[model samples]
Target: MVTLKQIAEELGISITTVSKALKEYPDVSKKTRKLVRETASMLNYKPNSFAVNLRTRESKTIGLIIPVIVHHFFSSVIKGIIEQAEKKGYLVIILQSNESYELEKKQVDLLLSKRVDGILISLANGTADFKHLNDVIENETPLVMFDKIAKMVKCSKVIIDDRKASYKATQHLIDIGCKRIAHFRGPLLPQNSIDRFLGYKKALLDNGLEYDSSLVYICECGDMSFEEGKLNAQKLLKEHKDVDGIFINTDLVAIGAMTEFMKQGVRIPEDISIVGFSNWFMASVISPSLTTINQPGLEMGINAFKLLYKEIKKKKKNSDFSFKELVLDTDLVIRESTKN
Candidate 1:
């Protein structure tokens, strides 16, 4: 009920000054801004978001599109985004694409219609064509991509070195007495998947190990549920009985594969060793805990939002903005899944 005008009257300041202070405009002194914020808080003065948005033409909101929500990595990323967005008084609109290109396109359209200030996304596996994303770019909507992104998207990006990480995982297995290693790779579409596969292949070539095509199998799905992992594990065991190690695409799938291996009387780290990407919580709990790549989900999310905010500010100022490609680091965690 209390208004900025009342605060201005009480402080004997102009309403324009009060408004500028509340918005943290550079024109206002820091001392004045602090007093205005404190007074507003004391008065419980909740600005009418709709009215303010109508005036500024900015919702003070951002959209985030992810491939899935039930995933531990994605969940962590969401938490990071929410925490970071809150600091700037920005609200987040989260949407899941279910890894479908059509669904992803729909989500983008929905966010655009909502008139959010900016968007952050992790592209779905099924997304190959950039037409829908380009539409957002053409519309001058600030966009930032994280994790699963396309190199051709021409937007700000936050990601780890998937290829290098995968290579280290494979090499670790080989160093620990693993021979005839197999790979459980994601689908060929997503850039990370392709990079991981290439990394695995390169490690094999570097180690003078045979790069056997028969040893590699695709393990991808909407949620990357346990079934796909188990099925691929079964397939790998049945066809490549001599395989002593596996580099799986994700922790969920890797855990599933481990389950199948256990049921089939395979001894983990003794008969076979496995490593996975994205060190989900389940990785540490599973028997013979998974030794995997620790992808920085929180960092990726925070970085994505930071980049989105920068673009949003630039767009608002009608300033020239260049793309930022931020690459974070990954760690190879050694655990019970691998022989020490």
Candidate 2:
């Protein structure tokens, strides 16, 4: 209930001077700024965010759209983004799309309506239509896509080279004398998943190995949980008894597969070799540490924030900006999962 007027009256200064001092405007003396801040803290005088946003045309907040927060990869990315955003005196609002296109669309609309200064999004799994994203672009809202992106949207993006990384992983399996490689792919719609699948197939074909259609399993069960991975691996093994190598879309899935393999009394790297994407923490901790592609999730998160910040600054300058697709290189991390 304590308005700027009350603070001004108590301080014996004009309301405009109090306002400027609270905002730390250089025009106000440092002594006035300190006194106003102390008084505001005592009074618990919180400025109306809507009014501040209206005046500056900036919410000083960034919206982060992620598929899921439970996964280690997304959690790490969020940590990196928040750390960087905090350094710049910005706040982040997180929204989970839950891997649904409809939910993602609704979240995007809500963020736009809230007038977020910028949006950093990793598209949902089944998001094929990008009209919602296009709406954000039309509104001239700075947008940066990371990980799973809308290919049609020409905007700033930060992602690892999934295709090349997958190729290296598969090639490593082949070099280790394992043929009949099976792929456990994620949803087909996300470009990153498609790219990783392509990389797996390319490695097979390039090495004069036949691409077996029977060996490809699509895990489109909404959640990429360890249970799903275990079930899918079991089904794949049932159908293809000769599957000697496995390329999973995620480290979690690979862990699940390893569990099932061990239960089945299968010798790892002896009877079968395994590779996974995203070098999550469990990958290194699990028995027979997983061989995976290090996606640089935290680095991608930092880069995404920087790109969004640049876009916001460009908008403030009233300058036209070109889209940037930043593809960070990936590394094939070798461990006990694969042999030779």
- Among the numbered candidates, top lDDT falls to 1
Best by TM-score: 2
Report, for every candidate in turn, its global Cα lDDT versus the true structure: 0.92, 0.91
> Which lDDT tens digits does candidate 2 get at residues 1-340?
8899999998999999989998899999999899999999999999987787898898999999999999989999999999999999899999999999999999999999999999999999889999999999999999999999977898899988888999999999999988799999997789998999999999999999999888988886866779877898789778988988999999998899899988998878788899999999999998999999898888989999999998899899999888898999899999998886
Query: Could you estimate the TM-score for every candidate?
Result: 0.87, 0.93
Residues 175-273, candidate 1: write the lDDT tens digits: 998889999888879999899999999999999999999888885454577888999988888898899999999998899899999999999989999
For each candidate, C-alpha RMSD in Å?
A: 4.7, 2.3
Clashing pairs in 1: none
Stretches of candidate 2 above 4 Å error?
11-17, 20-49
Candidate 2 lands at a TM-score of 0.93
